[model samples]
Target: MEIHFTKMNGAGNDFVVIDNRSGIYDDLTKEQIERLCDRHRGVGADGMLAIEQPVEGSSSQYRFRYYNADGGEAEMCGNGARCFARFARNLTTEFEDEISFDTIAGPLVATFPGEDVCIDMSDPFDIESDIELSLSGTPQTVHFMNTGVPHVVLPVADVTAVDIVAVGRELRFHEHFAPAGTNANIHHVIENGHIRLRTYERGVEGETLACGTGVVANALVHHQLTGAASPIAVDVQGGDTLKVEFEKDADGNYRNVKLIGPADFVFDGTISI
Candidate 1:
């Protein structure tokens, strides 16, 4: 079957978006997703997204279903959600400055501010210690938080020196996280209250230019450690700066968490299966 898809990117993490509200295309398989994501042999992308009609009275009228290049469905994707919102808007030409949609992680709301998209990410779960494997016989001091998806945030002295591919794989597959893995993020605090980060995503399985939710996770972890709030700037390995805003209640629950970053349109085309 042949399908029409849009290629989009947020920061640097890219995706192939398909609109399935018409239900015209069914029978999508993992192998097809993988083939389409092949960088050299096919239309390469980090993952694939499908836009479906949201259930009645949903925060919005579209539901985003995401699959990694491996064809496995992920609970949520921060960067992908931004791309999904943009794709949906363009598909219907029904643009809204703010949009709400549902994902496996629950309802997500996003707002377009100027030329950027900011998403209200899920509140984080602050675990006292690393629930999974610690850093290679090192102490278990990493902060655990779930912003859309589970992430292991490790503060480092120099993020650049860290081998993200190797260490990230180790943590992502740690037995504690089990059958389903988690994304790994390495963070370093830069000057003037900015944090630098590199993330190894679970589905993509490598470092991308930027991760929307990963940036939010890093910012929240930084705030937990440093007690700073309001807004935090995150420098991603992709060389883009993502701004994060949140409110910490008296009990330290992170609410009103938002990630602001660039969502750009690369180009669009149709493909055959």
Candidate 2:
């Protein structure tokens, strides 16, 4: 079987975007998806995005189905969402700078305000603070929240020195977020409205240049602790900057969340399975 695809990146987190509207690519085996994301054997991407037909009563132009490099289905990917929007726009003549898409998480509205595609993300829920975690026989206070997917933020002094692949994997598999593991983020505060972040994603099972949802989680957690405002400037491992904006009410509940970042086309090609 031959399939067409576009390689795209948002802040260095890359994805293989496929237009599966015909529904023929819907039943790809997990092994096939995993192979497609294999760096040595396949196209080499952090994940794959399948553009499928919209669900019943969905106002989105299409539905975005994402799979991790490990071939597991995910509810959403912040960076991939931007790439998906751009791919949809390029194929959708009616869409200008904005597009909406449906996902397992829910409907998302994306707008290409300028060079960046800003996505209106769903509200962050299941927020818990200072949860104790055993890190190498030492106690660590990690904050938890679900931004589309579950995440645990551990404030660190230097993100560069942290063995994300090791510590992150330990936390990712911790019993606290068990059964379905959580993504781990090493967060450092630059100041109010600014921070540096590194994430160990669940599906990818390692740290990428950037993690959109992780950045959002970083900003929200910062705000919750420091009483900072919206539009936080976040510096990611990919050396790319992403902006996170949200409105938090009196009770610390966040709403109107938006993740703004770059989504660029790397190339387009087809491959045989």
Candidate 3:
């Protein structure tokens, strides 16, 4: 089968987007998705986004399905959603400042303030603080939350110096988050407004250049710790920068969470299955 695909990236996280409005590959298999995102054998991306038709009265502009490199479906991806928005705009002439879509998790909204795409990432909840864990015979504290998906944030004095693969891998599958493992992140606060982060994504099973949801997770954790305000600038493993903004409710929870960053077109082509 010859499938038409568009390759895109947001800050460095890449995706293979297919306009499956025709349902040509409706019965897509986990193996197929894994092969498609295989860096050595297939299109090579962090994940794949399929633009499916919105269900009746969904109150959404469209529906997007996400698949991880491991062929697992994801609830939400901050960077991929931004790339999804840009890819959606490219497919239709009805361009609007704001675009809304439905995911497995729920409905989401995206907007273009400039060249960068900003997504209203919805509310974050299920916060667990000071989680005790044993790493290398030492006890450490980690913070956990769900911003569309589950993430565990570890505050380190030096992000780059930390062994992300080892620690992140251990924590991601830790007993605390058993059954469905969590994405792990190590972050360093540069100051009140800036932070550096590195993530070990669950589906990707390794660190990528950037992660949109992870960025929001780290920033929100910082806010809870330091009373830092919104519009926090985050520096990812990739050289590019991303911005996260949100409004806190009276209950000390975060809502109106937004992730702002660059989503750029890389290339497009036809690949056979």
Deviating ranges (above 4 Å) for candidate 2: none
Q: What is the C-alpha lDDT of each candidate?
A: 0.82, 0.92, 0.91
lDDT tens digits, residue span 1-273, model 1: 787888888888889888899877658888888888879866888898899988777867688898988889888888898888877767654657767788988898878888888888887774545444456887555767788788888888999898999889888898777787788889998854589999998888888878887888888888877876569999987778889999988986888888888877887788887
TM-score of model 1 (CA atoms): 0.93
Model 3 agreement with the true structure over 1-273: per-residue lDDT tens digits: 787899999989999999998899898899888999999999999999999888788978789899999999999999999999988987777867788899877899999988899999968888999999998788999999998889999999998798899999999999989999999999999999789999999999999889999999999999988989788999999888899999987987788999999999999998887
Each candidate: how many clashes?
0, 0, 0
Residue 15, model 3: Cα distance from true site in angstroms: 0.6
Local lDDT at 227 for model 2: 82
Per-model TM values vs. the true structure: 0.93, 0.98, 0.98
lDDT of 3 at 60: 84
Clashes of 3: 0
lDDT-based ranking, best first? 2, 3, 1
Q: Tell me which residue pairs clash in candidate 2.
A: none
Model 1 pairs in collision: none
Model 3 C-alpha RMSD to native? 0.9
User: Regarding lDDT, does 1 or 3 come out ahead?
Assistant: 3
